[model samples]
Target: MTQHQAADTVVIGGGQAGLAAGYHLRRLGIDFVVLDAQAAPGGAWQHTWDSLHLFSPAAYSSLPGRLMPPQEGETYPDAAHVVDYLTDYEQRYALPIVRPVRVEAVHRDGTHLRVETGAGNWRARTVISATGTWWRPFLPAVPGRADFKGIQLHTVEYRSPADLAGQRVIVVGGGNSGAQIAADLAYETDLTWATLREPRYLADDIDGRALFDHATARRRALDEGRSDTGGVASLGDIVAVPPVRTARDAGLLKAQPMFTRLTATGVEWPDGTRADADAIVWCTGFRPALSHLAPLGLRGPRGHLLTTGTQAIGEPRLHLLGYGDWTGPASATLIGVGRPARDAARAIAALLGNA
Candidate 1:
């Protein structure tokens, strides 16, 4: 039951990045359509753990043309609130989004890019791929990892502390997810935090506003051809959200260096000390979900497309948005994504002579 559809521009993904690009394209009066793989709105935010919250406040973490409604008396918005906000944003603009259309490939079809999907295919003058990294969770291949008999899952599969109640758990990685999840489970269960190196724990008061300002300044420095300050904290660093702050206050934020290998029952340290655990939660990050664009032969090292302000340098018809600083400074966050999305939209419009 596959059919072929056509659009002046095709935007892949329906998350914050895709929606922002859609807003800009609509403003330009472009005949663009957004293709979302998810059955519903909210994108990857819908898939995060139940207790997860944004490190940024509502005002600072928003897409273009709209603001995320603030959580009641909370410094950070929970994951559900973000989902609701994204859903509302999609409905508010009446953006043209095709649901449940999992794009399988995007390749050359003469001058246009052919977007192959499960439901149908799209022929577009240009394509904007805003698919973020959640779907491709990265787990290092540790020795004896497969032999572990205990439960093991990445943060993507984690939902609640209830699912992991009372188990001796090892939480791995130094990012926000690892810190938050460890903090959540540390009080409920026996948990150990593991990182390759000591984590940079930003002050509990430092939130997304401070990080955004730093990101803006970094971008400004790059623009001015000046050396970066190299002092501002990165978003990747652990921010002390309430739960994490409480855990840190309780002496639970201490982390052990990563174990050398996994044991059938647990993990083994370099000194041969074995830590027994009922399960392991890998808070390791993700790679870009760009399997659809394999046919273009444009993916460079690390499977990332080199872009000049959102437009792919190797493939002129392709643009990547919201993957992170590669596309734009802080482009992965809600507030930081708008600029890259606008630049992507403008580039596509200009290419199609519709600008």
Candidate 2:
């Protein structure tokens, strides 16, 4: 309600995507506020499994203006390293960020946007949502899921492998998290990896850097009205990180086709074979964390809101980021989010007459 409390733009989620938008908005001299739900600065990185590392090298995994400083002798920065970098990036620009502010919803307040939050309300001419999907970790409604008497966890709640020692564990999902967690847990537990389809691997030498480059080049070509050939990589394809490579050598990364259903103690294959498992870690990924925007009635039947170039269709005042390729090509990555964030900020500036 006060002059200082309101801003030309309010950025929700201060993670990579939100920080990138904040950086661009600052450079454009836009009066904006960023609301982060986390108590700290790292966003979802703060909550990842301890040994998690980016598949890309440090040079390729950076924010808008600064390259992520590589840890000495480290090819990829671990999750903690990333958190430190994000924390520093936030301070370097002095972005107007309010922390521990869980936004409940966004409402159309006449000509402006009203952000309802636990901390307080913020009214802005534009609202950019960068809340990535980590919070809404998805567990598929498998048959007998509730009937399974053993422990079941989503990757969002999984922190370390120490707790899984000597137990039979089924790590579900085929993506990077599945590989990485399976790699670590295999050393201490009887681990089985499960994926819907066979997991595709990039060439051992190719990492996130190459994947990002190829993806960007192809995206550029597509934007220029040219058919893109030589598609490099899918964002979902797992990279052969060192641990995963090691796991492969140890025969620990071998994946079984997804089981038809969960049994009381474990999972059952179509052939009537069952594996006894003490725990099942579902790494089945996430949906967009746009529950706060439900008031706008924008979600489609598939649970995704329609968007045209980052702006929500039929709602020009709202922008989305960091969910996945639908929002922007590779928008969920540290390096990939910068482009969309910049574009969103530029558009928001123009909308607010600050451009």
Candidate 3:
């Protein structure tokens, strides 16, 4: 027999965003279910390397109502600490989460949304898609990549530095992961970072405080269109100079040009540069995983689900929390997801009342 559960709202992806949304829905008296693919919560943080830690300070990383464990000074928490924190948050809020059940597809049937998961089927008046940015790691297609004899893997598969110990590593991409991994592997093996853009580095602190504030400020400016810049710029482009130059001088890592081809032993860079590597870790970032939703006409030309100004485009019952620019830095951070979740819960409640 097929069991079907119904709710006022259904949130997909039980990461920080989905958990936060479920918490808000419960507070608003909206019957909701959070569907997550993982056995537990914490999103990608749960799967990251053992040594991974947030770059932002604890003060900025606290979720609403619940604060991170008291840590003296401004320090980032490791991945394990974050997972434990999220687990605690779920228990405290008593948020209803359906775990280890992968959401296969979502479709709108008249006024309701139908969610099909590996566990079962669910129907809800509304849906909140809170899947975070790192759901799918983007790896650029390169010629001869399959022919490479060495192991090639995405950052998603990386678990710890021990996996690469004593091996020559090529960490691709210039983002935070690329930089951090290369730095961590410095004492373990020969490391190289490759990217098309010249690398810019930021200092660990700004004016005696963690420099994440600068990132927050820039993100705010970009989202509000208050900054003189027309489009988003990389974190390295906007940060101050001293930190940037200092990081470059550290010499723990250096940037290589873009990848051109893959050889049996390693990669070939454009400028005819080539290096032998025993392993390559692609930290190329991710895109929203909405392929299961292709049947619905929701995505934009850029492949993102087009929202009606920050909300859902055609379906008022559908909402997207933690999407960039919808609220601010909160859209990108675990702590920031609370507000959107609250709003989404309210929206769902109101819709249910009318229905």
Runs with alpha carbons beyond 4 Å of true place in candidate 3 = 1-3, 71-74, 206-249, 326-330
Worst 10 residues of 2 by lDDT: 228-237
TM-score of every prediction relative to native: 0.97, 0.95, 0.87
Model 1 pairs in collision: none
**lDDT scores of the candidates, listed in order:** 0.89, 0.88, 0.72
Cα lDDT tens digits for candidate 2, 1-355 = 3432688899999999999999999999989999999999999998888889998888899999988999877888899999999999999989889988999999998888889998778888999999998988888989989989988989988888898888999999888888889898989998999999998877789887787777788778888999865555444478889999998888778899999998888989999999999999999989889999999889975678899878999789999988877788788899889998998988887888842
Candidate 3 lDDT trough over 10 residues, lowest sum: 237-246
Q: Mark the regions of model 2 whose C-alpha exceeds 4 Å error after superposition.
A: 1-4, 228-236
**Clash count list over all predictions:** 0, 0, 1
Clashing pairs in 2: none
lDDT (Cα, tens digit) per residue for candidate 1, span 286-329: 99998888898887879888778888887888999999888888
Judge candidate 1 against the unseen true structure and give its global Cα lDDT, from 0 to 1. Answer: 0.89
lDDT score for residue 341 of model 2: 90
* lDDT, residue 281, model 2: 96
How do the candidates rank by TM-score, highest first? 1, 2, 3
Show pairs that collide, candidate 3. 330-336
In angstroms, the error of model 2 at 149 is 1.2
In candidate 1, residue 338 scores what lDDT?
A: 91
